[model samples]
Target chain A: MASTRAVLIWGALAVAVIVPVAIAAHSPLLAWRSPVYIAAGLAGVVAMTLVLFQPLLVGGYLPGLPRPRGRRLHRWVGAALVTAVALHVAGLWLTSPPDVIDALLFVSPTPFSAWGVIAMWTVFAAASLAALRRRLRLRPRVWRLGHTALVMVVVLGSVVHALLIEGTMGTVSKVVLCALILAVTVKVLLDLRTWALLARSWR
Target chain B: MTREHATRRAFLATGAAAVATLATAASGLLVPARAQGLAPTPSMRGGANNYLPGAPIVERIGGGGFWMTGSVRRAGDGAPLQGVRIQIWAHTTEGHERDPHSHGATLTDAQGRFRLEMPQIVPAFGQPHGHLAYDDAAFETVFLRPVMPSSRDTSLSADFVLQPA
Candidate 1:
């Protein structure tokens, strides 16, 4: 029964990620788009799904992966997430530099662009801190608190960014994916007792 | 004495009327004349994306059974501008909007009107919409993405009143 449940959960996760990419692949809008643009766009779609995996793996929600192994996978996934973000931004930069500049400067007329920029920066900050953790010689508690906070921001910013953009993504599937990312993250954070850490830190 | 006062008052009123008439005429002259008695259509924000700078002209998008139609007129005077190239693209039944097969360009006829037939527009980005653009040196470029009222609509029409560059 448990094995069947694990298979079902994994399958569900697969659908959540695969459905958006599939929808985008068939988007009639792709006809005139540059290859760089398509690659960049798919990277974004993948990154949003990756956001879901971070919390699930860190919280050890997946049955097959042990917590320590899951944490290691989480780190790899984090690196992948950052790489995907770079591809997304780079593709846009190549396609439309002015728009990307506007987004980076936080002066974009489109609300979604700003959200995306915010999420991108937060993800980078989290990645940088992770890389420098040993050099900083921070305590486990401090590291967890800081990383968890940034990850939460990444979740919020990315979800808002994804939701606001009206792009190749299908509406129903996109909303479902965003909602799942949010709910799962919140659940994982709660299970991990993020608030208790905060309380202890305050004391 | 009362007759003299009345005459002075009449002279002031005539001057005021004359001044008002000239101001109205000047204002009309200052504003670009609209021959069609219609205001220029403002471009929508976020209307242009996946725009191809210069897609070649095509006779039709793809065995076009569904009509995508619109008119183009000058903003200064609601005069139809002929020989203007108008590009049309849409997510359609045969191909995605991003496909080269899904995009095509046509010229405005002498009447300042343009039309093309393409496969029926499919829901793209969640709504059934068609994109049209007037990217030429002759007029300020305008990109339009107009949504059809219903996915089942057989045809969609969008018109443009372009400002001179």
Candidate 2:
């Protein structure tokens, strides 16, 4: 029974990430820059998806969950997410260096470019903090607060980025993905608050 | 077996496997040898009136015009395309210099060489038009406007080589 429940939860998590990817992979109407660009964009979406769900995974917010995997997987996954974002930016740079530079410097004539750049920086900050938290000897609460704040920025920026990009994902899929991101975020936050309250009561 | 010996043997086996795996992975990442086999060539085809003798090459030669040069080749097999018409036109940064709509067109010569002049100016905020046309279909069309130079003498070079779509 425990195994079955675990499988179902894992399946749900996979769907949350995979469904957005599959929808964004190809659209008859939108022509991608190249196969490489498409692949990078898809990877970014998956990484963002994982980042959105990381808090829940870390806190073991699943119903009837087993003991969380000693936080090693969490750290590794966070690092992987950062690498994926780098690849996404690098791929875009290779395909269109001028546009990528404009986006990064917030000088892109396009409005959406600013949002993507902001999200990228926020994600990078969050990952860096996560890596250095141990060495820095930061308080758990402070680290958690900082991480959460930056994550919210990343989510907001990503939502806007996805919303503004007309290619591939299109209006419908973009809306769906944005909704999923919001739903997951809300769930994770609520669970975290509840866990905090429970810990306080225990004390 | 003694515990120390058993541990050493296990470690040795694991180390060997890891080394082998790393070597294999590294080789896979190395640049493939070009001389080991025939270099892969892209396929090209000609159709209808668009077919020309010799290959057509278009170059934006940095100054005023894009130099379009190619040998005309026969549609069947690999014969030089010759004499087929190739039209080239793009909007200048100053806003559609040739056409009122900011579009331009020209034809290729007998040797498959053609040149179209573009006046240096700032790129327009909107789309630029430049394409290769044969028969009814236009291929290798760049929808975005080229970055316009600030001065007339400032040169920018771009090349367009068309292949079977």
Candidate with best TM-score: 1
True contacts kept of 2: 0.00
- Score chain B of candidate 2 by TM-score: 0.34
For all predictions, the C-alpha RMSD in Å is 7.4, 23.0
Worst 10 contiguous positions by lDDT, candidate 2 chain B: B43-52
Which pairs of residues clash in candidate 1, taking residues 3 or more apart in a chain or in different chains?
A28-B96, A28-B97, A28-B98, A29-B97, A29-B98, A30-B98, A31-B98, A31-B99, A32-B98
Two-chain DockQ for each candidate model:
0.08, 0.01
Candidate 2 structure quality by residue, lDDT tens digits, A53-162: 66655666555543367255667777888888889888767654655776777765557778888989998999989889999998777787788889889888888887
lDDT of 1 by residue, A77-134 (tens): 9999999999999987876565577678876556778789989999999999999999
- Which lDDT value does model 1 have at B78? 82
lDDT of 2 by residue, B116-139 (tens): 554443322111223333432333
Q: What is the lDDT of residue A34 in candidate 1?
A: 66
Quantify all predictions' global Cα lDDT against the true fold: 0.82, 0.56
lDDT of 1 by residue, B1-165 (tens): 356555767999999999999998998889755554656677654456556668778878888888988899987668898999988887676765556787888899999999888888865433577888888897788888787888789999999998888
**What TM-score, to 2 decimal places, does chain A of model 1 have?**
0.96
Where in model 2 is the C-alpha error above 4 Å? A1-8, A29-32, A63-67, A194-203, B1-165
- After superposition, which runs of candidate 1 have C-alpha atoms over 4 Å from their true positions? A1-45, A64-66, A86-114, A136-145, A160-176, A196-203, B1-39, B42-58, B76-85, B89-104, B107-112, B119-130, B135-139, B147-154
